[model samples]
Target: MRKIIVSAAAAALLASGSVAFAAVKHTTGTIKTFDATAMSLVLDDGSSFTLPKTFKDPGLQVGEKVRVSWEMSGKNKVAEAVKIAK
Candidate 1:
């Protein structure tokens, strides 16, 4: 019984650690292109992100500086939020 409890605790710890590693990441750069119809954007530094279906446009445009909050989903960087930057 004690061994089983310890094993469960270890498993839980590993799960929590993975969750922490998967936390949202942020990037800032000038917008190279934004295709609202395609729900995607690329930064001048060559980073690309796919906007969520529920994402609202914040008037993104080429050459605009913006910050993107995102996370990796498979091979894609999925954007959680986008905010225009100064």
Candidate 2:
């Protein structure tokens, strides 16, 4: 029984660690392009991200500065949220 408890605790710790590592990443830069039809945006630095369909549109336009929160989905960087930068 004690060994089982220890094993369960170790598994829980590892699971929590993975969740912590999956934290969202943020980037700030000018918008080079925003394609609503394609559901994607490119930054001035050439970094591009696929935006989720539920992502709120801030009426983004070319050259507008913004901050994006994203995470890796397979091999693609998928944006979870975006906001205009002050």
Candidate 3:
């Protein structure tokens, strides 16, 4: 009985760890391009994600190298930030 309980507990921990360490949405890259109409960004990592159209005014531009962090919803991802490094 004790062995069975221990195995179940270990399985639960493994399952939770996978979810808790889900892939991070942060990446560092230069803005390859931006289209106001499209509200999309092309990063140097060869990956891209769209910014929330409702976000406050953007203070970034193409060619600026910045760190980006984002959040995911369903199959879509939204840019949570775009910051320049000192």
Candidate 4:
């Protein structure tokens, strides 16, 4: 009975921890620069993101407003998607 309670508690904690780590961050701003070669972009607000190697161009352009979905990898914010914003 005690072992069962402890196992359940551990499982609950583990589930919550996984949910916390699975969070996808988001940012919205005008693009300041874009480099297809580097697979990166900088926002006018100074935020920068590294795009995935398989990323396809979304017709991004400087001064265009955008919404970026991303996740943190080491010290970099790796972009998962970039969408043109109205």
Q: Give the per-residue lDDT of model 3 (tens digit) for 8-83.
A: 9999999999876555578788888866678787887676778787755357778888888886766766788767
Model 2 agreement with the true structure over 1-86: per-residue lDDT tens digits: 99999999999999999998689999999999999999999999999999998877988999999999999988899999999999
* Candidate 3 Cα RMSD after full superposition onto the native fold (Å): 2.9
Quote the positional error of residue 71 for candidate 4 in Å.
0.4
TM-score of 3: 0.65
Highest-lDDT candidate: 1
Clashes of 1: 0
**For model 2, where is the 10-residue window of minimal lDDT?**
52-61
**Which candidate order results from sorting by lDDT in descending order?**
1, 4, 2, 3
Candidate 3, residue 25: lDDT: 76
Clashes of each: 0, 0, 0, 0
Model 2 TM: 0.88
* Model 2 misplaced stretches (Cα beyond 4 Å): none
Q: Which residue pairs show collisions in model 4?
A: none
What TM-score, over all chains together, does every model reach?
A: 0.92, 0.88, 0.65, 0.88
Those runs of model 3 whose alpha carbons end farther than 4 Å from true positions after fitting are 1-4, 71-77
Model 4 scores worst on lDDT over the 10 consecutive residues at 17-26
Cα lDDT, all candidates: 0.96, 0.94, 0.76, 0.96
State the lDDT at 36 in candidate 2.
94
Q: Tell me how candidate 2 scores on lDDT.
A: 0.94
lDDT of 1 by residue, 1-86 (tens): 99999999999999999999799999999999999999999999999999999999988889999999999999999999999998
Give the better candidate number (1 or 4) by lDDT.
1
